[model samples]
Target chain A: MLKEVTAATFENEVLQSDKPVLVDFNADWCGPCQMLKPTLDKLAEELDNVKVVSVNIDNEDEIAYKYNVSSIPCLVMFEGGAEVRRSVGLKPRPELIKFING
Target chain B: MYDIIIIGAGPAGMTAAIYARRASKSVLVLEALTYGGQIINTPDIENYPVAAHISGFEFATKVYEQAEALGAEFVFEKAVGITDSGTCKKVKTTENEYECKAVIIATGSANRKLGIEGEDGLVGRGVSYCATCDGAFYRGKTVAVAGGGNTALEDALYLADLAEKVYIVHRRDSFRGDETTVNTLKQRSNVEFVYNSNVTKLIADKRLTAIEVTDKLTGETREIPVDGLFVAIGRVPENRGFAQLITLDDAGYISAGEDCLTNVPGIFAAGDGRTKDVRQLVTAASDGAVAATAAVRFVASLE
Candidate 1:
């Protein structure tokens, strides 16, 4: 299951977590966000050492602003509380897996 | 070796899978992004025959399901390279590589971005290439759409119903879209046309706030306070990955004719990625059918 993270809980859930976290910065109004739901869900289920979380830009604008997330369906990989990589737009499952592993 | 491998999952690629499966050829489809391609950005599709007014997502999903039911296997992977061996072809993707007797390049096109200042930085904040994907975010607010093509007109029309006001900024005095679409947009009270003008700058800080429009003939510039800017200029073919394996036109589209036959003997090109006169849903489907038939014939010759 994909966990929903807010600005208040972002530090504990994503930044300070032991496992690498994949943060999906998305909004309800974005169509690509809707399209990316299944791929993220699958990634969350398949990966053991990674935590997948979602932050709605509409609700958690501060977190979005902090990460400089200007686009919907922005996938940010956080390792040791620092952003290691970021990808914009909808990517397929295989590419998502490759991205997370890399 | 697999009988055929198609590198894309859009309408053309999916249609090729259907035809290849019907021909009793083992088929594999690899897609880089989510299925549906640019059509997913379209809110409504009216031109596809028999489907008068279906959402682009629904249309693409139905076609995908049809292909799936026909026993064609699909994998979500981006093809990074293609190599033609003496008797077979090798396709390298982000995840894995596959060998096949025949290959079909059906990768479609991506939306063209407005290379204006701040356009890249403000992509998600307020600037978007797909109006249907981001239009709801700017509901009841003012927005501007650039270009004079069918996509631009469609974006303006779609935004008119959602936004308080929409400005269609076109470099040409007239639109290149269908007359009926232009007429429909002109009827909307919320739609405004900025003809013979270009978007010179994008004004934004945290997000998009406004845009600068310059009149080409008058040399007058005006700033429109818009919450979002939808760029619909055109699309560029997604053909860079396989450039080494096939010949490309000046515009980067694969050099293919109506038969979907590329310069490579066993490799075929189809859909919007190929050089064609008309890039439409119907034409894409037609290309898929032709390419699959040609691929099946090539495989038979090898046998």
Candidate 2:
């Protein structure tokens, strides 16, 4: 299951996580963001080493600002609290898996 | 190996799959993003034959269902590269590689972005390309659309119903859209036309607040306060991934004739990805049908 994280719990839930966290910075109004939800859900179920978390840019503006999330459906891969890789727009399931694994 | 591998799931790709399946060929469609391509962003589609007045989402869904029910297997995967094998073609995606006897390129296009300042920074905040997806968020607020084509006119008309005020800012004085659609948008009381102007800058700190538009005739600059800015300028072909495999035009569209046959044998291009005069729904469907038929003929020759 994809975990929905807020600005308050982001530090502990994502930054201090043991596994690499794939953070999806998104909003309800964004069409591509909504489209990426099913892919993220599938990733969350398939991957055990990575944690998939969703951050609503509208609700967690501070987190979005901190991460420099300019676009919706922006996927930021965080390892040891540092952003390792980032991609924007909607990607397919295989691409998302490759991004998380890499 | 599969008989055919289609590299998109839009109207063109799906239609191609439908035709290929009817030909008794094992077909696979790989879509990088969501299906429906650019049409999904459109709220209403009246031009498509038989569907007099239908929502784009509903139309796309019905077509997808039809293709799926016809035994066209679909995989959500972005094709990274294509290699020319002796008898078959190798399609390398982000996940796995698939060898197919024939390949159909129908990856469609994406909305072109205004490369002005603050435009990239305000994508989700206030800047949007799909009015149908983002129009409801700006309800009761003011918004501006940039372009002169049918998309810009349609966006203005769509936003006018939701936004308090909708401004159609085009670089040219005259719109290039249909006269009927232009007249319909003009009749809307909430719609305003800002002709002969260009959006030079987007003013925003964290989120978008206003846009700087410069008048072409007068050279006078003015700021329009808007809650959201919908960009419907145009589209760019999504053919970057297949550039190494096939010949593309200067504008990045695959150089294919009416037959949708690319420079490479056993490979075909279709839909908006190919060089064409008209890029409409009907034209794309026609290309799909033609391309699939050509692919079937190519596969039979290999046998």
lDDT of each: 0.87, 0.86
The TM-score measured for candidate 1 stands at: 0.81
lDDT of 1 by residue, A1-102 (tens): 478998789999998999999999887655567778877988788789999999988898778768766557889999999999877788767678889998
- Candidate 2 lDDT by residue in tens digits, B1-303: 899999999999999999999999999999877777766645568999997887665677788899999999998778888999767799999889999999999999888999987776578678988787667667788999999899888788888888999999999988768899899988889888998999999988657889999999999999999878999999899888889879999999999999999999989999999999999988999999999999999999989
User: What ranges in model 1 sit over 4 Å off?
Assistant: A1-31, A46-88, A94-102, B43-55, B183-189, B218-220
Model 2 residue A64 lDDT score: 76
The candidate that achieves the highest lDDT relative to the unseen native structure = 1
